[model samples]
Target chain A: MIIAERKPVDEIVEMVSGVKRVLVLGCRGCVSICSAGGEREVEILASLLRLGASKQGRTLETIEATLVRQCDREYIEGIDQWAGQYDAIVSMACGVGVNFIANLRPLDVVYPGVNTSFFGGSADQGIWTEQCAGCGNCVLHLTGGLCPVARCAKSLMNGPCGGSVGGRCEIHKEVPCIWQAIHDRLDRTGRKEDMSRIAPIRDWSAAGHGGPRKQVRDDLTV
Target chain B: MSFTPDIRVFCCHYTSQQAIAEGLAGLKNDGFPPNATIERLLCSGKLQVSTILKAFEDGADGVCVVGCPVNECHNLMGSQRAAHRVLAVRKALNELGVEGERIEMFHLPRGFHPEFVEAVKQLDERTRGMGPSPFNGGTAK
Candidate 1:
């Protein structure tokens, strides 16, 4: 899932400073699971915006709404119900949702309320950590179900770097060395020989190095 | 003219048992601030950041959350959860340029106790020093 965190209230307040009425949009997708952008977050943000405006001696009218998912055109269309009630929109979805709203509604002014952090999963209750880089390539099968591309500090395809000490990354003491964990996992599974197979130099084009990535399914396309 | 802060207090059922038992008049007799309002919940863990923010939006000069002692909550981790939510609201208040001190969390023993009233008194005095909430626009409600 994509992990996001809300932008500072001051920055968001600044974004909608001149707009008397604004839409606080939320997405019930990955962000909702991560507790960044959801119905509850929409309420928190809308209330904060109003309080911030009040503190400044101005009144801000907010319209709060959450869609099933903002990454799809069908759900993006749900925003039409709010129509002209808002002069601007504060999207609590990840960057993709904000872009979709912008791409589909050229005349609408939309602003991002969250900083799209990364593709991650909940590590624990109220804790999320980066898990995937979405590099458009598959390497998990070769690396004991762990992608160093996302977990390693240097994205090393081979074994742990020299910076690894006592199975911890030198970059941060709290970060366990992913390569060490990969090696241990393979060893425990009696697949240690796989580590001997060196990874070849990789192609960069598939990992968004070529430009914005897109996928179209002819069977599903209308 | 002296300023009277409009405070909102959210307490857990277990922690606020005394207040609930005393009724409004009894609390007044015991020196509970007349300007403050008490909202009782089954557990403070149910308190949400949005709820606290809504209180400020509704003209609360300050907000207080009284929950069971951290280690003795009836629901185990309920008070801890409430503490985290109050911290979240404090961060939001600071972000909005309001004093984060406007909101606070107190973990006190259950049932009737001076400590609960004292906690509110501290918040009341603190909020008085801060004057009316910026959201209140120098008006007391």
Candidate 2:
């Protein structure tokens, strides 16, 4: 799921100025799953904005709607019929959803309600951490399942460096040494033999050093 | 004479608004406070708590949402969704130090304007006694 967080409320109110009728649109996809943009959040924000606007004696007509996926056309069509009634929309989806809403209608100004963060996994509920750099390399087989590129301070490609202190990285006391974690996981899985096979000198070309990569799924598309 | 109240009401179109003429007559008795204002909505089930909250935020002493009763929604279950939302928002308002009674919901079947007006007037009195929203407390203007 796409991990995201709400931009501060003040920013959104400022962005929504001069609007009389506003739609608070939420996405039930990634952003909802992550708790950044969802039905509840939209309502909460609408309440907050209403208070702010009312304090200024400016009344605003608000409509609340949630689409299955803001990034897709079919889901957005759910609210299309009522689009003209609203002056503008505050999209609770990620950046992709924001842009998609923008492209769908020339008249409505789409404002992002959340800051799109990264492609990551939940560390736990209410907590998420970055896991992939989209580095274009699948080296997990060599270092156990843990990602060295993301967890290691140096993004080291090899075994532990001198920075390993009592099994923690030098970058921060809280971070366990990535090499140690890799070693422990390999030992637990009895895959130590897999580590003996030395990874060849790092292939910089395949690892996005060669620039953008594209893979066409012929079967899936056709 | 008992003090009448101005209850801000949002009547759903298909059911409540469709029955407004009869409802006004039904509510013309002293049961409804004189200061109340009635607003219309596409569906009471369409009323999100934010709509109610914004009303409170807009300085309405209280907000009353009248929708088709649970089983009678024009959109089939829209009222149920609104009920669920009202419950959740009540919890939120409580947490924010706002009175839960400031936001309320009721079911209105088609042709039940009398019942609808009574509900609105009663709610208005209840809220007027509670005073303006704590968030936009009276005359914070």
Fnat by candidate, in order: 0.91, 0.38
Clashes of each: 0, 2
Taking the candidates in order, what DockQ does each have?
0.86, 0.19
Candidate 1 CAPRI-style tier: high
TM-score of chain A of 1: 0.98
> What 10-residue stretch in candidate 2 chain A is worst by lDDT?
A48-57
Clashing pairs in 2: B6-B35, B6-B36
User: DockQ of candidate 1?
Assistant: 0.86
lDDT of 2 by residue, A1-222 (tens): 788887766577777778988899999988888988999888877776666565455777778788889988777767677757888899999998988888877677889989999778888866888776667777887888788887788888877789899999999988889889898899899998866676677666766777767678988885
Candidate 1 RMSD to the correct structure: 1.9
The digit string of per-residue lDDT tens for model 1 on A1-222 reads 999999999899999889999999999999999999999999999999998889778999999899999999999988889898999999999999999999999999999999999999888999999989999988999999988999999999886999999999999999999999999999999998998999999987889998999989999988
Best by DockQ: 1
Per residue, candidate 1 scores C-alpha lDDT tens digits across B27-132 of: 8888888889999999999999988988998889989999999999999999999999999998888887788999999999998797888889899999998889
On the 0 to 100 scale, the lDDT of residue A60 in model 1 is 98
> Which TM-score values does chain B get in all models?
0.95, 0.78
Candidate 2's displacement at residue A142, Å, is: 2.0
